[model samples]
Target chain A: MNAQAADKTVATMAQTRPLVAMDHVSKIFSNGTLALQDMSLTVRGGEFLSLLGPSGCGKSTALRIIAGLGGVSSGSIDWPSSRINSKGLPEGDISFVFQEPTLMPWQTVFGNVFLPLRLRGVSKKAAEEPIMEALTAVGLGDFAKAYPRELSGGMKMRVSIARAMVTKPRLLLMDEPFAALDEITRQKLNDDVLNLWRRTGITVIFVTHSVFESAYLSNRIVVMKARPGRVHADFPLVTASERDALYRSSEDYRQACEKVSAMLLEAMGDAPEGH
Target chain B: MTSSVPEMNASSERRKDIALRIAVPLVMVVGLVLIWHFGVVMSGVPPYILPSPGAVLSALIGDWSLLFPALVVTTKITLMSLALALIGGAGFAIFLVQSRWIEIAFYPIAVILQVTPIVAISPLILIYAPTTQVALLICAFLVAFFPILSNMVQGLKSVDHNLLNLFDLYGASRWQTLIYLKIPAAQPYFMTGLRIGGGLALIAAVVAEFAAGSAGASSGLAFRLLESQFRMNIPRLFAALLMLSALGVTIFAATSFISWLALHRWHESNLKREN
Candidate 1:
């Protein structure tokens, strides 16, 4: 949000460690739709990566496979920096934020944030401090007793983020978590997320269609194409200076946006109409 | 002073809204009773053929000893059947939802039972059950069972796919997913089932007793109505009918209150709209 806050987050030492790698991963849905084809990607330990693409590009499918929500038809995923579980995926060190907030309607804000810890068999008393910490991290400390229905769209998304972060996961997968929010709320959340990532040093793989958002938040962007989906372009948007409102208005940011936009258009051009 | 004035106005307006909701319904009921009393008196119908409101009131007080015991019998049967249905339906739904194969195998059987009229099966239940009370309970339980099972099944299946993915990403065990996610997610639907089943349970209990025609000292209000009709005690029959209607209304109110309690904080159906 500001130059000083961004300066503190430029400590990029954790980006080199290979965390998980997909080797020629391909997924064909039961209905015979090929969602992804021969897609290989390695997610590092602490980098902010964005899977940027249009609809049907399988960016979501790729993220799902990485999170072990879907299986590859012809390839395997390897975890180099984390231990593999019996399911052959990374163990219980991951969290996912859905496009929708996805909080339980019956639960209060605190209860929703308590879910991941509760599922892992942590007692409520033991989970109190971490739950409060997570809530505070998301700026929802005052809404601990409020139900999901009482919150605004942005606040509900904040609860979702709190829920995801409560476990102090090593990896966080966000599937366009702010896509439904208004622009102002989305921008605010982007800054908050960047700050949280900086403070925790957690790895984040964010999926998005917004060029501005991806350009602003991601250190690395993977632009994907549809029609038997696969990655078409991969690039780093590293900046020597801190990214703030000034950086956004800068010519460097304008060029980065133009570059990503042109690549997205090219990817869209490759796919058929109505995609 | 300006802010406080609007706040006081809003509070008073809210109180007035609550008062109007209760007052209008009470006024309607009073008006209906007055019309009925006058209509019966003006018609000059004999008390045996049609009892006036005053006659009915006298009968209600005069027969209170008999009617109270009968009301208790009916209430007990209704409540017990509802409890059984809740246990049976929710348990079966959970069991069926655990495996698609199990749901596919058993859901049709549940549908068959639901479609078959309870009236058609009441005779068989009466013949098979060890006691008349047991037969009445069985009929009520059968009537109440389907709505709960159907709603709960739909609720369990309706869990957001992304939330399921989030749970999977966290390596949540099946039991943990059921308890922490699926069950709470299914609550609104479960409450809906309870409301519908509550009314159905009462209807089935009374109807089953009527069909059984089992008259004894311990017989329900339905039996008292039949006995009063047979003995030309029309005023007492009206009293029993009044008690039955009151019981039905009470069950509906109680079920609705329970639903409101469970869902008012979060569910869309229970939340009050601002406009």
Candidate 2:
């Protein structure tokens, strides 16, 4: 099966409950630019969702709001309280991966990955196994002692991913984490991320500009429009497998990509093909 | 991109660095000795006006009895003053970072101290303080204080926003942020300030000695220089000058090496590898 069929499956699954719920979220900058406007979304548990849009469409803004890094001007977010209630309010339980790797230059790969745990007063000796596991998950076990300056762009991003995952966060918010890498690296990282997600069963809210990337990775794609950014389309990929070359190359995946691309183009005030 | 060319270039670069580092000072030393010897031989200049390098060297060795004690006294003053300056400067910097109101209130005072002539202030300090050593310490502390405060303030303020946000997301307390993030972020700047302040402290101690005009009770290098001038002991004066120069160079080199070592492992300022 392909993205469309997988999305149908997820949609049916989401009918029961949502892991994250946003109600009428709006954001206006001090300079009066509206980054988001009355947007609402519900991310189901264990779902891989992508906020897809053109440049300046506020997909990132939306993600930041969900992560509580940016505040909503006029709406409420009702994230599932179950995870927090059990763990004393999961204060640092959510992790964010920025477009830039944003690794601390003064830390080794292992040190960066261990930061969240260290901040929680976990000893280096205690966190060693978990840090190693996270690094191994990101294929950076060999680079544990390496600093950010020693890593390639893709490798730095892998370190960033490892840092986020080391805490085993229930909700991971990624803002175009692979946008800075080349196509090959991006594709490879996309696969690695899907594998990690499948293995961990963690929820992901990723923001990206590429419709094809959204179709390839996300169980649900939230297509956003600019100029008071709001959700223009919400398309879910309905695939059985986490990722497969055959599913990516299938006719259904191509149609979903085309549909989202067309929706994005229209959002940017461009005429669709054969208009 | 040829391996041979890059390898050759690396070796040649190393060779050039070694040559320049050794050759520049060696040539200067040789030339200065030759100039001094010839000037004494050619000009019927009195021994007091222009002492030969040999005579200065002889005086330095022969008068070791008097000069060694003076050297020790000067070194103690320099070290003590610098220690005081470091403590005071760092204390003020921490205060400045704690409140904008404190910064506004005290930054101008620091600038005023930096701008005021040390030579001019030394006399006033000598008169007001209870003892000559105390007066000298105050003078040195005043001269060395500003750079540490200014550089540290800038470093503390220049912490990466993402890192700050990361700490906040992890629910790190204010004290944790200061100790873990702010202080480490400020290391380069603090070291820079300390390096500069180290040199300034020596100058201030010398200047204070000159202003105090005390004949004994912890008289430093400056007092010896003055005594040499008053008694027409030009060779001994040159010996004292040599000691001062050596002291200055030692302080600078020691501080620079410390800065290098502090940053060599992790910071980009001294990173040895490139991606």
Candidate 3:
């Protein structure tokens, strides 16, 4: 199928099912600074969405709100309440991967991944199989007993991803999990993450400052502007089921990157002087 | 490069690193003893005023029958007091982490204990308590409790904000947070406090014994030192002092070693790496 046709099909799919709906969300900090203002977006189930913006933008703030880690000063977040059982209705199972990996330095890879389960009263013996599976999924199976200090930057992030996935959370919220990795490692992880998402069909909301990364990894990119940060533009990427290394080097990918970069520059108030 | 080579090289390098570190400290200690030995011999200082190392060793050997019992008494008091301090300090830290009101109410009392001299309160504590051992335990607990409480409070509070938010999003209850998150996070600080507290417990026991003035038939190393000094048995006094210093060293090293074993597998405090 052509790129344009694939784009139409993806958009149709997104329109059919919304997994997370944010309605005119506004966040004002205690310092009276408006971090997010009147922003609204919908993330479809099984879709990869990236909140793309420059530094100081409220992309992270928006993610935190959806994760229930932060409260919106105004507006509401409507997550997929249907997925949660009656007792767990208020909060669904979701995992967050932070910018710095943020793995507990005092825990081995296995221990870190087993933390959520351990917190829920699952014994170590019972959690071993799932923990091992998660570690294997992240390609850190051999490093399960290794401490965070012993791992390289990329390895630590793999551990973080393993930890996040161990609970099989319905929604995976990642705040630039690969920003600190070198380009090669970041590309490898991006592919690994896409594979995981494809197999599990889990919804992923990633926040990134890089337009190239958002273009490459996301089905939909929510562009944010700073200074009372809010959504400025939303760009949807067209992808095929057989996306591969060649797909990344395709003309469509280049076009998407250029388009998102333009939107980001415009959002940062550095739009071409000629308008 | 192959992964096996790096792993093998790393393990060997670690062994060499440990050897070098121990060698440097060992050499310094040997040099210090040699200097002390030569200085004492050349100066011809009277045994009463400054007993030679040989004289102290002989006195220690000669009075082993008397000194051994006193050593056992002192050690018992030190260990018992430290155990009580650990329990009290950890309990207080848990309470402090539970509620802001409780922390604000009780934290100052801990600070007051930290600042107050143990010597000044030992006599009063002895008067009030039913037994000398109980009074000594209270004195030791007072000296050791504050650092553990303060360090642990800071550690519990200092958990990575992102990790804390992750726990909150996971719907972890307060008790779950305490056991799973707060306690693990506080382990390093608590271990550090335990190391310091172990030493402080010893000091408090000795000082309390000194202040109590050998009332009971049973007496500790402190009493032995006092008796030796009063009788002008300078070599015996020096021997007791050496034993006390050795006791302090042993307590510090043993606690630190335990902390290392517990945390070396994961924590940065136990890490041997440069970065």
* Top candidate by TM-score: 1
lDDT of 1 at B78: 97
TM-score of each: 0.93, 0.91, 0.90
Model 1: residues >4 Å from true position, as ranges?
A1-16, A272-274, B1-10
Which runs in model 2 stand beyond 4 Å of their true positions? A1-17, A82-90, A240-242, A245-248, A270-275, B1-16, B271-275
Candidate fnat values, all? 0.84, 0.38, 0.72
Candidate 1 residues A110-224, lDDT tens each? 9989888887789999999999999999998989999887789999999999998998888899999999999999999999999898789898999999999999888789999
Q: What TM value does chain B of candidate 1 have?
A: 0.95
**TM-score of chain B, candidates 1 onward in order:** 0.95, 0.89, 0.92
- DockQ comparisons of all candidates to the true complex: 0.57, 0.47, 0.61
Report, to 2 decimal places, the DockQ of model 3.
0.61
Cα error of candidate 3 at position A128, Å: 2.5
For B182-254, candidate 2 gives per-residue lDDT tens digits of: 8888999989998999999899888888888878746788999999999989999999999899999999989
Point out the worst 10-residue segment of candidate 1 chain B by lDDT. B1-10
How well is each residue in B1-275 modelled by candidate 3, as lDDT tens digits? 23998889989998998899999999998888788778899999888988778888999999988888888888998998888888988888998878899988988888887898989988889899998878877888889888888888888898888788777877778888788788998999999999989999999889999998764446889999999989999999989988999999999989989999888877777766564
Interface RMSD over true interface Cα atoms for each candidate: 3.7, 2.9, 2.3
Output the lDDT of residue B140, model 3. Answer: 80
In candidate 1, the residue pairs with backbone N, CA or C atoms under 3 Å apart (3 or more residues apart, or in different chains) clash, namely none
Docking class of 1: medium
Steric clashes per prediction: 0, 9, 0
Please report the candidate that would top lDDT against the real structure.
1
